[model samples]
Target: MRREQPSTQEAADDRTDALRTEATSSIVGYRLRRAQLSVFQRFLTVFESLALRPVEYTVLVLIADNPGRKQTEIAEVLGVKRANFVPLVHGLEQRGLVERVPSDFDKRANALHLTQEGEAFLAHARQVHEDMEQELVARLGGEKARKTLIELLDRLT
Candidate 1:
């Protein structure tokens, strides 16, 4: 039987080729959407267990803390378009978690207020939101990780 032997440089060349292939595979464009969606999915898991979406949670908290805030102001703070937020506000109203009272300053505008029921719901939502924040930090690591990611996101936006 005859045994075939491979040269050392041939093996070295093979290794270099493999390295180049792997490097090419690694060099790709930003996977921002993939990473963003992953974060959102984790958020959804925590939010779904509660009875509110993240947006609703935010809205509830804002209303809870800033009673008599105008809907337009809330939309501004959230950086959401007023047109888009109208339906979200309506949904909260339908759930009886919030009420829209006519603004004393502007007859055409409405000021938002958390009713007694809304306050109760907001309290529970706050607890859930806090728990979710903890879990998010845990998954993403400590403050540094979150801050770094937030900075990167701000740049992208």
Candidate 2:
């Protein structure tokens, strides 16, 4: 008797399982990259409609939480190049989601802050991100697994 061929989805699922069982899964760099890809895919699904990229979301959150922080300071914490950071901030400024003002302590450094519009947008964005995070937590098994994974990752960082 001849066996039926697997469907495309079945083949893909098999391939995915094979990837998880591969030696690369044991490597921190490889595993982290694969995990980042999965998380970013879900992030896109949640934030694409709002036209928010991950870096932008991080910047928004940072500025909202640390109002008056210098652009350079935020860039440093996020490990973004100054050249790249400028355009990111510019895009947010153009969208009226952020503003820069001269720092009171430093004449040269510009302090970052979320505009009223940004504050409102961030509220919705954060809710979407929370939903995405819950989805990730469920997929990773449960809250315990999520907490353990986060703790492990934090140790590395």
Instruction: List candidate 2 stretches off by more than 4 Å.
Output: 1-21
| Candidates in order: C-alpha RMSD to true structure | 8.4, 6.0
lDDT of 2 at 71: 99
Error of 1 at 54 (Å): 1.8
Pairs clashing in candidate 2?
none
Assess candidate 1 and give its TM-score to the true structure: 0.70
Q: Point out where model 1 deviates above 4 Å.
A: 1-30, 151-157
Tens digit per residue, CA lDDT, model 1, 52-94: 7778878988988898889999999999998889999999999
Task: Tell me model 2's lDDT, rounded to 2 decimals.
Answer: 0.94
Q: What TM-score would every model get versus the actual structure? A: 0.70, 0.84
Q: What's the lDDT for residue 103 in model 1?
A: 89
Give lDDT per model, in order. 0.82, 0.94
Q: Write one digit per residue (lDDT tens) for candidate 2, span 1-157.
A: 9999999999887784433566766889988998899889889888989999999999999999999999999999999999999999999999999999999999899999999999999999999999998988999999999999989989997
